[model samples]
Target: MTQQASLVALQERVAAVNDVLNATSVLTWDSRTMMPAGGAETRGHQIATLTRIARDLLLAPETERALEEAERAVLEFAEDSAERRMVQQTRHAVEHHKRVPASLIQERAALRTVAQAAWIEARSKSDFSIFSSFLAKTVELSRAYADCIGWNGHPYDAMVSIYELGETAASLKDLFKELRAGLLPILDDARSRPQPRSDFLFRDFPEEGQRAFGLSLAERLGYDFRRGRLDTTVHPFEVSFTRNDVRITTRYNRNYLPASVFGTAHETGHGLYEQGVDQAFTRTTLATDLVGLYAVGGTSFGAHESQSRLWENHIVRSRTFWQLHFPELQMHFPDQLGDVSAEEFYRAVTRVEPGFIRVEADELTYDLHIMLRVDIECALMDGSLAVNDLPEAWNAAIKRDLDLSVPNDAYGVLQDVHWSTGYIGSFPTYTIGNVMGAQLMETLRRQKPSLDASITAGEYSVLAEELRTKVWQHGRRFMRDELLERITGRRLDPAPYLAYLRSKYAA
Candidate 1:
């Protein structure tokens, strides 16, 4: 066959692999949100089988030759066009995939499944010991996976490359250091100031009303119900298989009014991004390879976090958002909100709460939660920490960082399910994403000062559209740094995030 024909065939093969991956993603989502407990073993086998298939297809020598040939054709014919971009992306993914052993791949998938089951059981019983052995094994597998990926700076950096390309531990450490310097003082100030009137936030709220408020908020933010659905999970997450089948799940706390509302808005931010990707790239090599390249479209885990945080904290917690919805809050909890003004409600939700649970943490204290997890993950991955000692270590970090004590393992080490799923070295992404979101929003505000008014008016189209144009639509066509610079004219600096915190809390 001619070289052009060979490249076309290679593209077809890559598309087929993505189709299998998308299908597998759907099953994985079900395993988390909808599947019954009895189906765990079968689900494990299914995920393992599919993972092996993807590994083998990407590892196949014929596909490797085809990819190389395709790259040559694109470079020779199109130079620096979209065709070459597709070839470069395909090559990059296969190179990393080739580095990871198939045995390790299958093992991680199987371990994650069983570990998830054990986590569900442990979390239900609030018993960390029940899941300790499984978690230990998961950590072991993650370390091995990290070594397979290889890194010059840190093993954690190698692991991070799986989710965020071209990011290093040193880079993140420097960013966090700058962040820490700015944040500690702001936190001190927040502590010194008169506390906001948050007593009203804990007032009795009906679950039905909470759900209605969340759905209405999501709709106002442009979440498409036809293409996506929201459900309740123990912990909230958004997982997508394709544009038409994105699912977001949130946990509802009846006692706390903002849990479901903000949680849904956060996950919806993720869902909308998934739904907004370049639709024309669907079912192709250009499609599956697109998401990780851009700085805005979760260009990094931090980029994704920015969207969630933007919606959850910056917008949802803002006085403007409440001004638009004080009536709704009154409708839901007339006894609670009738006497309260919008400013009071805003300050209440935005109160700086030092908490053990990361999900329940307020915006200011949230990074401390993330830093605590980052420390634990780093220790666990490097063999300095033990699974059995996790609770003590967790409490120690919480106390040192937030000056708070943990009352139980449920509220302490077992609060997050990330460890149960072989996702070591992933906790930093939450804080990093928060920083990225704040920085991006700063740039966005400069472009459109009326964002506050737009948010209050319940019109998020302009903001969402800007993100789609700058971040989401490009998919993974550019490197994270390249994309950030291209879109925002600045690198990914955590300083903006820190500045944002200082201005909000300290000022």
Candidate 2:
């Protein structure tokens, strides 16, 4: 086929594949949000069948020929052509899927659906045992997955690369070591100092009021409700069918103010990234961050998480941010927050209390939660840790790191939704997000020194615009390292993040 014809063929095939994929996305979203309890098994099978179809379509013999032909033309015409990126995306998915059998891939998808429903039950009961069999199957499936794809000494290298491209067990260990050492002094100092007294945050601020305030915050921060939406979920997340249909979900705790507020802000960060991608890429394969294992590792989850962390921790938790929003918060619950000063609220929100929940952790100890998980995941990958012993190991790690005993498995090994669906090696990206978030902020401050003032004024257009221009619009056109360097003029550095934590938590 002529290269031009080949390029057209590849695009047509990818668009067809995306139709199956996007429909599957809508089903998955509905399953999570609106599907009836009795529909779980049938939905699992339906979603898996669609997943198999998409996988097979992507790896079709004709599609491969078209991609190969188009790739050559793309390189010859211009190395950075969008055509080249698309081929790279196609080739990555083809190669990864080729390693595993079609039936196994479908089974894994079905298993994930069942595991998620089981997790909700286990979490509600706060019983790890209730989730134990599902967890075991999840682990076994993960191992089978790694075994199918083949691995060197580190099976998790492939596992983590599923979410964070180009990252490996060795690289993360080194990064985590540096992070832990840097954070220790900050954590120690923050703990030694008296915490700000703002128990009013736990006052009875009705759920309806909290949700309304949270949605308003999301809208103010460029959420574009006409194009996107906010909803309730057990674990907050953002999902998108296309740029114009981004949806985010957050759970609420009426007695704990920060729960819904930060969760909404965090998911909004992700929504903004999705909504900001080049409109040209929407509804295409290059659109969703869920385009995992599709390329060598473009748009790392760490990079994506940085947007959520940046908005949730650095901006939303800052004193200046409260200067603009505290009144709105008080308006939501006057008796709960009317007398609370903005600085006091900021201090309360930013408080460095070490806790069991990773999502709700303070900035200082947030990464420490990731560190524990990284260690556990590594041990699981190496066969040093048993799946059944996870709760004991988790509790021990918590006690060692935070000096807190585990009261139950829900707050211990069963807290996160990642593992229920076989995302064992992905937890560390939250820490990576923290590091990258701070690094991005450092770069942003240099570019627009008045960015904080804009945030303080309840005018975040400047910050949103900067991130869109520098980071979001390109989507998978660049990998994580390439994106950071192109946006910040340097590679990832832990020093800035370390310094950021120290400055924020200094006694």
Question: What is the per-residue lDDT of model 1 for residues 312-399, given as tens digits with 9 covering 90 to 100?
Answer: 8887777778888888868877887888998888788778878777887888888878877777777787789888898999888888
Candidate 2 similarity to native, TM-score: 0.96
lDDT (tens digit, per residue) of candidate 2 on 1-507:
777888788888887776777687788778778877677788889988987888888788988888888887777766555667777877877788888888887887887767888888889999888878988887777788888777776888878878887788899989988988998988887888887896888888888998899889999988999988888888887877667778899988878888899999999999998888888775455664333422111267788899999999888888778877788888888888878888889888888888889888888888888988999888887789998999999999999999999899888888898886667778888888888888999989988889878877888889999999888887777878777888788877899899988887773
In candidate 2, stretches whose alpha carbon ends up further than 4 angstroms from where it belongs are 1-4, 288-298
Q: Alpha carbon lDDT of residue 327, candidate 1?
A: 87
Q: TM-score of every model?
A: 0.94, 0.96
User: lDDT at 173 for candidate 2?
Assistant: 89
Whole-structure CA lDDT of model 2: 0.82
Best candidate, TM-score-wise? 2
Q: What is the lDDT of residue 377 in candidate 1?
A: 78
Under the 3 Å rule for N, CA and C atoms, how many clashes does model 2 have? 0
